[model samples]
Target: MNNNKSISVQNLTKKFGNFTAVNAISFEVEKGEIFGFLGANGAGKTTAMKMLIGISKPTSGEAKVAGFDVYKDTEKIKKNIGYMSQKFALYDDLTVRENARFYGGIYGLSKKQIKKKTNEFITELGIADIADNLVGSLPLGWKQKLAFSVSLIHEPKVVFLDEPTGGVDPITRRQFWEMIYKQADNGTTIFVTTHYMDEAEYCDRVSIMVEGKIEALDTPENLRKQYGVDSMNAVFLKLARG
Candidate 1:
């Protein structure tokens, strides 16, 4: 997996005032891999992800995302990655195509490229009828899907999803994961964070954070076996008890 390493974290740490949000975590994400980042509330998963994505600088240690150093090359790293936060980062007042244009422009996508990709995304998502409709008029599921597509408008090498399926129904979550799988199959590295243990099984490999440390990391099968548990929930229960 050496050549496949798309993101590397080494003893990364982040602090706020006197509290340590992310405490010395290290890991690597391979290219074309669906890497699951799992954690409970206040476990520092989001903090670690922020540092990796270059929005939050590490307090100590080092990290490289898409081959750019987190400390000094944030701009370069920004160009190589796309991000979708749980809060749905989109313009509610803008139409679907207009929203796409706004995000595409921010990522420096050429006008021609944005037009081409917007058409393709609308056709694939079967949302051409509402292409000109304001994003606020769309359903939650449709907005989530469109936000994902817009994030990738620049064709970034890596995409980070922070609880991308947070408020969706079970069916929509399933559908969202399917889209993530398609992108992974197309050679895009997917670094996702989720609280759903069931969704963790769908990842190529998963890492569980407990109090800002990677307490468990492996394929679903191996993790279950190692914990002597039949399901990820049981494994998580055991870990949480410790």
Candidate 2:
């Protein structure tokens, strides 16, 4: 394992019965890089992410995350990664402070650390006045931002964000990416999956999946230039259609 690589996979495969969910795929994500993982529905992107996050085991081949082998060190991998689903996982019934405390406890953070994070969220996010308000009462954009901050409470080495901005408005999406950029700048490896082609441009590097395999992996500029397209949307449409 290379010390500089946050995620490393080679010939990684996941199968169920006779069907292969994720075909043999290989790639590496450098530390502190924002890597965009894209794919259409049923493209096996989620399956591949599951293996990397230690949610599910791979059928064959090798994979490593945060310097731990995926096959044997699943527990260790989980401890080093934070995750946020596209659907958003914050507890609607819990207030901002309560939710932070809840997740902080789950991560084994001490009371002092949780209090510090809650105060940071209240101050940094400028939501101090509403810190005690229920999360469900907040706007979708607000919840999205809060959920992101919660995921980093443990300060994991890598974060797996699955389509985090799925239904957010443009302004919210931009704000969300700013937070992402800040985290990346702090040396956090970001592994994000998004359907919005424009979001692809924000990534340092991107990998597009098709039929359970990574069909294209490169910077957005190189991808556009390679496909002779003007936008990532066009690049995706061409690849997804073909």
Report lDDT (CA) for all predictions: 0.91, 0.94
For model 1, where is the 10-residue window of minimal lDDT? 1-10
Indicate the worst ten consecutive residues by lDDT in candidate 2: 116-125
How close is each model in CA RMSD to the real structure? Answer: 1.2, 0.8
lDDT of 1 by residue, 130-204 (tens): 999999988999899999999999988999999999889999898999999999999999999988889988999
User: Mind giving the per-residue lDDT tens digits that candidate 2 earns over 121-162?
Assistant: 788889999999999999999999999999999889999999
TM-score of 2: 0.98
Which residue runs of candidate 1 sit more than 4 Å off their true CA positions?
A: none
lDDT of 1: 0.91
